[model samples]
Target: NAGVTQTPKFRVLKTGQSMTLLCAQDMNHEYMYWYRQDPGMGLRLIHYSVGEGTTAKGEVPDGYNVSRLKKQNFLLGLESAAPSQTSVYFCASSYYLLDTQLRKLFFGSGTQLSVL
Candidate 1:
């Protein structure tokens, strides 16, 4: 079973172009997240969902939107891509974080997005 997978592993966009990155997992976990990693920096959360039908904003959600319509998939959309939004996007999931072994976050390789 795939833990977490991100689509459009690499992408290039003109400033103001729109794109949506897809994330999917088959683990049936209750938590999923979107994070972007700028070069040489730590991952910053963009959006997250604790379970299906519920989405929440995170540290950097300004240029992105997310949805979790099913238990297995989460999507991150950039309505208008910008040079500053150019970064590697990673999606993660786990059963829990507060008190569980599976609390260890699992990450996708990430989508390398570039905006010109």
Candidate 2:
């Protein structure tokens, strides 16, 4: 999509292997987030960035790392892939509306990752 794009729509990784998920947004949003979708846990935040060069941990930051070197790009890295890490990952960007005191998120198509 034009708003957000995630590379490698699907992937299969072996235990102990490493990989990185790339997220790019063209909307010029102020906030970017990385989330993983599990069966019953729903969407769990992995990491987020409020702006360029700023990164923060979220609900589930363990086993993952993130970096926001540019305003339009956010990267999620897994040093060691595991079965528990297998899930559908989503990248989203949002912009705040001062007048309405609200924000809207634009999500990527999602990446399906399987750790064997």
Candidate 3:
């Protein structure tokens, strides 16, 4: 069963800290995404890349960064951690965007993060 997987299922960071979350997939998908789920804000996209060697900001791209150098891997980086940034980070992969022609997505369990 090849699908999306996230590294360090849990993490804790102090204010103004830094960290990098890794996401890998084995489906040879062409699209990858990073999102943060808050208490009531639902799932907001932080960044997404349509294919290798390209990346773009999403609905809530501020305070976060992402890179997609390899088609199978996407990385989310936090330069300075903040309390507000403490939320579940999810790594997702899809052969195609459900809303954009291709459908269905596989999501990893999640990364629970805490910031102080």
Best by TM-score: 2
How much does candidate 2 score in TM-score?
0.96
Cα lDDT listed for each candidate: 0.92, 0.95, 0.91
lDDT of 3 by residue, 76-105 (tens): 999999999989999898886567695567
| Candidate 1 lDDT by residue in tens digits, 9-111 | 9999999999999999888888999999986889899999999999999999998999999998999999998899989999998887565545768888799
lDDT of 2 by residue, 57-94 (tens): 99999999999999999999999999999999999999
The reply for model 3, stretches above 4 Å from the true place, is: 97-100
TM-score, one value per model: 0.93, 0.96, 0.93
Best by lDDT: 2
Q: Worst 10-residue stretch by lDDT in candidate 1?
A: 95-104
lDDT of 3: 0.91
Q: Quote the RMSD, in angstroms, for model 2.
A: 1.0
Once fitted onto the true fold, the runs of candidate 1 whose alpha carbons sit more than 4 angstroms away are 97-102
**Would you give me the overall lDDT of model 2?**
0.95
